[model samples]
Target: MPVIKLTSNTTLHYQEMNRGAAETIVLIHGMMSNLSVFYFNIAPMLAQRYHVVLYDLKGHGLSSKCTWGYHLQGMAADLIQLLDALHLRQVHVAGYSYGALIALQTAVSYPERIQQLVAIEAPDPFEQQTLARIDAYSKSALLEQIAAAGKAQGKPMSKRQLERNYNLYHFLLKQTTLQQDMLAEKDFMQQPGIDRLLHNTLLLYGTDSPCASTGKQLLRKIPNAQLAWLAGDHHIPVQQPFQVGSSINSFLQPRENRIHHFQPSATSIGVETPGWNLAM
Candidate 1:
C-alpha cells in the first residue's frame, strides 16, 4: 500500500499496479470498505493493460479518519487532492455503491480529471424511491431482530454472537447499513454539480439486485449512458470478476473514426456464466 498525505496530518492509503501504462484505472470502494475488496474482483483482469489504482476512502478500513464530517463531497475532494499529489491529471474511474456516488461528485467537481466513468449499483442522491428503499431496509423486521439480539448480548458482537443473531429471513436480505453514515443524504443532495457530469457516464447494476431500477433511471438521464445488469445481485463483480472485467474492458476500449458498437443493448449487461458464488 502507498500513502499520500492530505490536508492536516491525515494520510490516504492506496495501491497501484502496472504503473507505466497508456491509461490508468482508479478503483474506489464503497462505504464500510477498503481497497482490498477490489483486488480479487477487478485487479487481476485490469492489471495487464491499464495502470490500476485502488484506495481506502477517508474513514474506512486502513485509512485515517480525522475528518470533521462524513460528507461524500469531502471524500471527493480528498480524491482530487490525491490525484494532484500523484501528478495524475486524468484517468478512467469506476466506483461501486457509495464509492460510485463519490465518483459522481469527483466527476462534477473536476470534469477534466476523468476520461470515462463507470458506476455500479450507485443510487441517486435524494430520490423518493431511494429514500423509501433505504428506509424499508433500515427498518426491516429481520434487521430489527438482529439489532435487538446484538444489544441483548452486548454492543461489540462476536462472530458466534452474530451468527446466532441471524434469522432465516436475515440470510435472504443483505445488510445495507453496516457502516454507512445516515447523514450522507444531507451532504449529497445539497450539491448541484454532480448531475452535469453524469451525462457522460456508464451506469451498471445486477438484474437480481434490488437497486437495478436506480441504474435504469440513471441511464435515462445520462446521454452517453447505458445500464448493464449482471447475473448476480449486489455482488456480480465479486462473484464474476472475469466477466465483469471483460464487459468493462470492452466498453472502455477506445474507438477510431468508426463508431464501434458503443451503446450497450439489453443483452450486454449481466449475461455471463456464473463464476464464484460468494454470499455477501
Candidate 2:
C-alpha cells in the first residue's frame, strides 16, 4: 500500500525492504505485471544482500495512469523521480520484459544515476524476418486470447489449451507495442548529449527463450556487460528463481569492489560508498 508521488502528479505504489549495505537495488516489473511477481522470486534472495525497492509502473499496477502515452522515457523519468523522493542517489537496477527496456533507457538517459544494470531478455533492433514473426502475433485471435487470460487472472492455467491461450495473448501485446515503440527508438538511442555512460552490466537470457540472442547482442554492445543463460523460458526468473538467484549472487560477489566508483549526490542516496573496502 506504500506509494510515492512523482513530479507529474503520478503516484507509484512501491514496497521497500532494507538490508545489505547502504546501496539500493530497484526492481521493475514487465508489461501487465505488478511488483508482486518478483516478490516470490528475485526480491527475497536479493533482500538479504541489498536494500530492495519494487514498485508499480503507471497503468500496470496500483500506480497512477497517464492520460497520454505510456512511453519508456516517461517510465524512466518516473523512476528517477522516485529515487529523488526516497533520497536515494544511485541504485543497481534489474528489470524484466518491458521493465528491461525501461532499465536500458534508464542507464542511457541517466547514466550517472545507475551504478550496475542487469537487463533480462529485453528486445533490440531486429531483422526484417523478426518483424514478420512479430506481426503475426498481432492478429485479432491472439489479442482475444490475451484479453481473456487477463480477465481470468489465476483461475489456473492448468490445461495446455489455457496456457497456450495466455502465451498467445502475451505475444500479441509485445508485438503491438514493438511496432509503435520501434519508430521512436532510433532518435531515442542516439540523442546527441547522451554520454556512453559505462557500468558493469549483466545480460541474462533463458536458453530456450526467444530473447536469448538479444541478451547476447546486448552484451556485445555494452563494453562492461557479461552474459548468462538459465535453463527455462522467458520467465526463468519466475520458474527458476533459486537458480537465477544463485547465478546472480555468484557473479556479484566477485565484482563487489568495483561498485564504489561514484560519489553520492542528492539524486543518489543508498549508493555504494567509495571506501568500504570489503574482501569478497
Candidate 3:
C-alpha cells in the first residue's frame, strides 16, 4: 500500500492510476467505507480519460486512525493537504455520501483548488433520522450492517472480510470521536457560503434515496449546480457503477462551443472491464 504522511502526523493510504493523463480526479469514499468503493469499477472507468486518485480517509480503511478531526472542516483540510502533498494544484473531485459533504466543504473552503465538483448521495447533516442512526451504532449492529451491505451487492462477505469490518467499526465507534464530530456539523448546509459556491457542480443522487432531497436542495443553493437521478437508492454507486462513471465522465468532459465532447473511440478511452468484486 502506498502511504503519505501528512503534516498532522497521520499517514494516509492511497492509490493513483493513469498519472500521465492531463486532468486529475480525486475520489473520496463515504464514512465507514474505503477507497475500494471506487477501486474496482468507477476509478478504472474514469482513469480511461483522466488521472484518478483515491485515498482512505483518516481512521478509515488502511489509513492512520485518530480520535479527532472527523468533522467536515477538518476532513476537508485533510483533503487539501493531500492535494498539496501530491503537487496537484487543481483537480476535479467526487465523493459519495459523507465523502460528498467533505468534497463540498473543500470546494467552499478552497475554491481555487477544485476545478469541478461531483457529489453523490450526500445527506443533509441536520437530518434527525441520520444522526439518530449514527448515535445508535454498536458492534453487533455494525456486523449486521456489514452483512446487509454484502447481501445488497449479491455477495456474502468472507469471514476474513467480516473480521476486518468488525475491527474497523469497533475502532471508529469506540476509540474515535467520529460520531460526535459529525453531529457537530449538523448545520453545515445552513452556513453562509454554500449558496455562493461557484464551481460547475454535478449532483448525483438515487431517485429513491432518502438523501435525494438533499441533492435538490444543493442544486437550489449552488448557482451553477445540476442534479441527475440514478436508478437505485443510496447504494447507487455500487448498484450502478457504469451509469455513475458515464455520468461523471460526461460531466467532466471538456466542452466545445457549449457542446459536450466525449472521447468516442474506445481505443483512446481504453475502458477497463474487469471481473466485478464487492468490497464493504
The RMSD of every model to the true structure, in order and in angstroms, is 8.8, 9.2, 7.5
User: Which 10 residues in a row give candidate 2 its minimum summed lDDT?
Assistant: 264-273
**What TM-score does model 1 achieve against the real structure?**
0.73
lDDT of 1: 0.66
TM-score of every model? 0.73, 0.71, 0.85
Q: After superposition, how far is residue 156 of candidate 3 from its true place, in Å?
A: 4.1
Considering every candidate listed, which one attains the maximal TM-score?
Answer: 3
lDDT of 2 by residue, 1-280 (tens): 8898877787899988865467788989876566876787678788888898999986556786544345678778989988998888999888886688788888888888898887776755344433343334224324544565667893533478556545544543453354455445544434442235487776666767677676755655676666666666666666566766655554455344545432222221122112332121
Q: Which predicted model would earn the best lDDT? A: 3
For candidate 3, lDDT tens digit of each residue in 1-280?
Answer: 8888878899999999999899999999987788988999999999999999999999998999888889998999999888988999999999998899999999999999999999988889998776554434223345555678777986665779778877887788778888888888889999877999998888888777778778878978987776777777777777778888887888787776235332222111211112211120
Query: TM-score for model 3?
Result: 0.85
Q: Clashing residue pairs in candidate 1, if any?
A: 229-270, 230-270
Off by over 4 Å in 2: 125-183, 186-195, 254-280
The lDDT for every candidate, in the order shown, is 0.66, 0.65, 0.81
**Whole-model lDDT, model 2:** 0.65
Model 3 poorest ten-residue lDDT run: 271-280
The superposed Cα distance between candidate 3 and the true structure at residue 265, in angstroms, equals: 16
Displacement of the residue 28 alpha carbon in candidate 1, Å: 0.5
